[model samples]
Target: MSHEYYRRGKNWFTAIGLLFCVMGGIVLIQQLLIWGIDFVEDFLFNAEFTNEKVSVAMLCFGIFMIALGFRKHEEKR
Candidate 1:
């Protein structure tokens, strides 16, 4: 019984982490693209804007992943 419990716990961790990684990959890709576009547009025309928007957005997304991980971890606990 204890072994089964431990196995399930490990599985939960793996699943949650993988979920973040997969979603994070997609989000990170978009964030990178936004930076690339923003940079090109700004450089070509001398446009100034909030440069931190992309970073902040990425942080928020990371927070979401952490929150989701916590949720799954709590479910097991």
Candidate 2:
């Protein structure tokens, strides 16, 4: 039972975490744009538009994934 195998697996988790974080960040920016546009139209033209709560959820999940990626997985001797 070599520790190297566990270390390799840990690296994979870090990569996946980073990927999730980046994707979530992109989605968050898109949501902000949509919300900003909606707000402007509603203010200037009296139209109703709202930002979806899912964006915030995605952001939170992404941050959580990023934190997980940095966690160390050391095999107990």
User: Residue by residue across 16-74, what tens digits does model 1's lDDT show?
Assistant: 55565566567545655777766645643554444344444545566665566555232
lDDT of 2 by residue, 1-77 (tens): 76486544446555666676677667657655767756534543443333334444555676777677777677778
- Global fold similarity of model 1 (TM-score): 0.34
- The C-alpha stretches of model 1 lying farther than 4 A from their native spots are 1-10, 37-77
The list of candidate 2 runs beyond 4 A from truth reads 1-10, 34-51
| Residue 15 lDDT in candidate 1 | 60
Q: What are the clashing pairs of model 2?
A: none
Instruction: Specify the highest-lDDT model's number.
Output: 2
